[model samples]
Target chain A: MFALILPAVLVVAALLVGPMVLLARISLNQYSATQLMIEATTAQNYLNAVADPYYRGVMLTTLVMAFICTALTLALGFPAAYRLARMESRWKSLVTVLTLIPLLVGNVVRAAGWLGLLGNDGLINATLRGLGLTSEPLRLVYTPGAVAVGTIAVVLPYMILTLSSVIESIPRAVEEAAANLGASAFTVFRRVVWPLALPGTVAGCVLVFILCMNTYATAVLLGGSQFKMMAPAVYDQFSKGMNWPFGAALAFILLAATLVLTVLGTALLGRRYAR
Target chain B: MGQVRAGPGPDTVTREAVTRMRAAPLSPLAAPALAGPGLSVRLGRLAFLAAVFLAYAIVFAPIVMVVVTSFFDQEIVTFPPDGLTIRWYLNAWAQRDFARGFLTSLQIALAATAIGVPLGTAAALALVRATIPGRGFINTVLLAPLAVPAIVAGSALYMFYLRAEDWLDMDIKATLGGLVAANVLITIPWTVRLVTASLAGLDRAAEEAAANLGARPLTVFTRITLPMLRPGIVAAALFSFVASFENLELNLLLVGPGRTTLPVAMLSYLEFRMDPTLAAVATAQILMVTILMLVTDRFVKLSRIV
Candidate 1:
C-alpha cells in the first residue's frame, strides 16, 4: 500500500510542494538589478507590494472584479441549476451536455471567442450598427465589462454544475410537503430548498470566486494591456520585469487572498446556515 | 387555495393526488407545485424557461461566434458585408508556428496523461483501500495543485527549475522535459479527483473474496480492481489530456521561446493581429473537444465522475 502511493507522493513533493516552499523563501529575499534576486531575509518585497499604489490598485481591482463575477454567476446559475435538477424532459441531458461544453473549451479559446463577439469589428458592434442603434462602434472589448462577461462565462458552468448536483439530492417530497402546507412558491424555496442547498451554493461560490481571482487568459484577452489584475501582474513581474522577489511576493499575496477569502466565506456562510 | 389543508379531508386528499401527479416524472416541465394554477403561474413558468434558455445561449454564444467569424470571407472580420469562405482555416493551417505549437502541445499532453494517470490511480487506491493514517491530509496535498493559481505555480516552477539547473549543472527551465513535468503535476490532480470519485462507488467484496480464496494481492488488483476501474481510468486519461492540451497560464512562463504550445502561439498571434485565423483555430479546438467528449460519453457517463 505504501509502495503504491510512494511515486505520487515523491512527484508532488518535488514538483508542487518544493516549488511553493522555494517561492515562500524567495518572497522574503531582496531584488537586485544585476543579480535578479539576492539572498536575504527581509520583508521589503511584501512591503513594496502592499505599499505601492499600482500594485495595491491591481489587488483591489482583482478583488472587486472577482466579487462581481461571483455574484453574477451565482445569480444566473442558481435558477438554471434548479431548473436542470428538477427537469424531467428529454432535453435535460442535452442541456446538461451543452453546459459541459464550455468547460471543455479552454479559456484561451473561449477568450478568443469573446474577442470575435466583443471586439470593435466583432459581432455585437456589427449587429448594433446593422440595427441602426448606434452610429459608431461601441468600445466593448478591453473594458472591465467585457472582462466580467468573459470571466462569468468561464465560471458559470462550474457554479451551475455544483449547484445542480446538490439541488438534485434534496428530495422532491420536501418541497411538495411545503407546498401542501399552503406555502407559496417563494416561501417553499426560502424555507426548504434554500436552506438545503446552502452548502452547495457556498461551495460553488468559493470555487468560482477563487477561479475568478486567478483569471489570467480571460483578463489578458478581454481586459487588454491597460487593465491590471493580480495574476497578470505576477506574470509581468516575473517574465518582463525580471523581479523575482517581487513576483514571488505578489504570487504569495494572491494565493493568500484566495485562501483567506475562501475560508472566510465558507465560515460565514456555514455559520449562518448551521442548524 | 383553501382546499389543501393539513387534515386528511377528501379535498385535501384530492389536492395531494393532483400535486403528486403534477410532480410526476412524465411532466415535461415538472416545476415544484408551490404555485396554484392561474395565468400568473403560467407566465412564471414561461419566464423561468426563458431564463434557462438565455443562460444556455450565453454559455454557447462565444463558441458559436468563433465558428461564425472563422467563415467571414473578408481579410478583417466585419459582420454583415462579407461572404463565407474556408480560407481562414487554410490560413490557420499555413502558420508554421501554429503547426509546430500544435505538435508540441500534442506531445506534451500525451506524455503528461501517460505518466500522471497511473501515479494518480495508485495514490487514489492507496488512500481509499489502505488503512493509512493522515489519508485526508495526503489527499489534500495531492489535490492542492489544482487549487494553486496556475500562474503562481508556473512561475514558482520556473524559478525552482532555474535554481535546480544551477545545482545540477544542466538546463531544465524552458525545456520540453521541464514542461512535461509541470503538466504532469497538473494532470495528477484531475486523475486523483476522478479516480477517487470512481473508487467511492466501487464495491470491495470482490477483492475481499479474492483475498479469502488465497489469491495474491497483485493478482486480485490486476484482474478485478483494475478491470472495474477501467471507466474511471479512461475518463481520467481523457480529462488529463484535455487539461494539459488547453493549459495556457501554467505553460506560459515555462514554455521556451521556440517551443510555444498552441494556445501560447494563439495568444502571441492575437497580440499582433485580430484576424479570423485565430477564430478558425479556436473553432477546430472546440469541434475536437466536443467530439472527444461525445465519444467518451458513449462509453462512460462523464456526469458520474466529473
Candidate 2:
C-alpha cells in the first residue's frame, strides 16, 4: 500500500507542497526596486496589500467579477441541467459531449475566438453594421463584460455537469407524489426540487466562483490592461513589476479567500442537508 | 382548503380516489387517454427545452465560430468574411515554428500522460483500498493542485526550479523535462479523480474470488483488477493528455526561446499577427478532441463520469 502511493505522494510533495512553502517564504522577503527581492523577513508585502488602494480595488474587482460570473453561470446552467437530468432520449449522450467541448478546448484558443466575435470589427459589430442598426462599432472586446462572458462560457459546463448529477439523483416518484397531493407543479418544484437541488447549487457556485476568481487568460486576452483581476495582477507583479514578495502575498490571499468560501459553503449546506 | 378536508365527506373520498388514480399503473385502455402530457404542459416543456438548447448554442458559439471562420479566405478575421477557401489551413501548416512547438507539446503531453496515468492509478488504488495512515490527508494533498491558481502554480514552480539548479547543480527549468514535470503535476488531478471515481463503483468480488482460488496477489491484480480498470485507464489517459496539451500558463513561464508549446506559440503569434491561422490550428485541435470524445464515448458512457 505504501509503495503504491509513494510516487504520487512524492510528486505532490516536491511540486505542490514544496513550491507552496517556497511561495510563503518568498512572501515574507523584502522587496527592492533594484534587486528583485532581498532575503529579509517582513510583513510589509501583506501590509501593503491591505493598506494600498490599488491592491484593494483589484481584490474588490476580482471578487465582484467572480460573484457575477458564478451567478450568471448558475442562471444559464440550471435549466439546462434540470432538462438534462430528466431526459430519456437517445441524444442525451451527444448533448453531454457537446457541453464538454468548451472545457476540452484550451482557454487561450477560446479567448482568441471571443476576440473575433467581440472585437470592434468583429462579428457583433459587423452584423449590426450590415443591418444598419448602428453606424459605429461597439467597444465590447476589452471590457469587464467580455471577461464575464468569457469566464461564464468557460465555467458554465462545469455548473451544468454538477447540477445534472444532483438533480438526476432525485427520484421521479417524489415529484409525482407532491403533484398528487393537490400541489401545483410550480409548488411541487419550489418546495421539493429547489430545496433538494440546493446542495448542488452551493457546490457548483463555489467551484465556478473559484475558477472565475483565478481566471488569468480571460482577463488577460479579453479584459486587457484596463481591467485587473487577482490572477493577472499576481502575474504582473511577479513578472513585470519584479515584486515577488507582493505577488506571493496576493496569490496566498486569493487561495485563502477561495478556501474559506469553500469551507463555509460546505458547512452551511451540509447542515441544511442534515435538517 | 380547511373546509375541503374538514370531514370524511365527498371531498375526502374524491381526494382518495384521485390518489389511487395517480398511483395506479396505466392500463392499455388508459394509455390512450394519457397519450402525453397536457398541451399547456407540453408547450411549457418545449419552451424550457428551447431555452436549454439556446444556452448550449451560446456555450458552443465561440468554438464553432473559430472552426467556421478558419475556412474564410480573408487575411483578417472579420465577420461576414469574403470568399471561402481552405488557404489558411495551409498557412497554419506552413508555419515551421508552430509545427515544431506542436511537436514539443505532443511530446510533453505523451510523456506526462505516460507517467501520470499509472502513477495516478496506483495512488487512487491506494486511496481506495489501502489502510495507510493519514489517508484523507494524502487524498486531499494529491488533489490540492487543482485548486491552486494556474499562474500561482507556474510561478512557484518556476521559482523552485530556478533555485533547484543553484542548490543541486541540476537544471530542469526551460527544458522539455521541467515542462513535463509541471504537466504531470496538473494532469494528476484529472487522472486521480476519474480513476478513483471508477474504482469506487467497482465490485471487489472477482479479486476476492481469485485470491481464494489460490491465485497470487499479483496474478489477481493483473488478471482481474487491471482488466476491470481498462475503461477508466483509457479515460484517464485522454483527460490527462488533453490537460497537458491545453496547458498555457505553466508553459508560458517555463518555456524558453524556441521551446514553447502550441498554445504559447499561438499567443505570441497573436501578439504580432491577426490572421486566421490561429483559427485553423484551433479547428484542428477541435477535430482531435471530437475524435477522441467519439472514441471514448464508445468504450464508456461519457455521462457516467459526471
Please give, for residues B99-124, the per-residue lDDT of candidate 2 as tens digits: 98889999999999999889999999
In candidate 2, residue B103 scores what lDDT? 95
For model 1, the chain A TM-score is: 0.97
* Cα displacement (Å) at residue A266, model 1: 0.9
Q: Candidate 1, what DockQ?
A: 0.48
lDDT of 2 by residue, A147-185 (tens): 999898899889888888777766655566676566655
TM-score of 1: 0.93
Clashing pairs in 2: none
Provide C-alpha RMSD values for all models, in order: 5.2, 6.6
Q: TM-score of A-chain in each prediction?
A: 0.97, 0.95
Model 1 clashing residue pairs (backbone): none
Provide the TM-score of chain B versus the true chain B for each model in turn: 0.87, 0.84
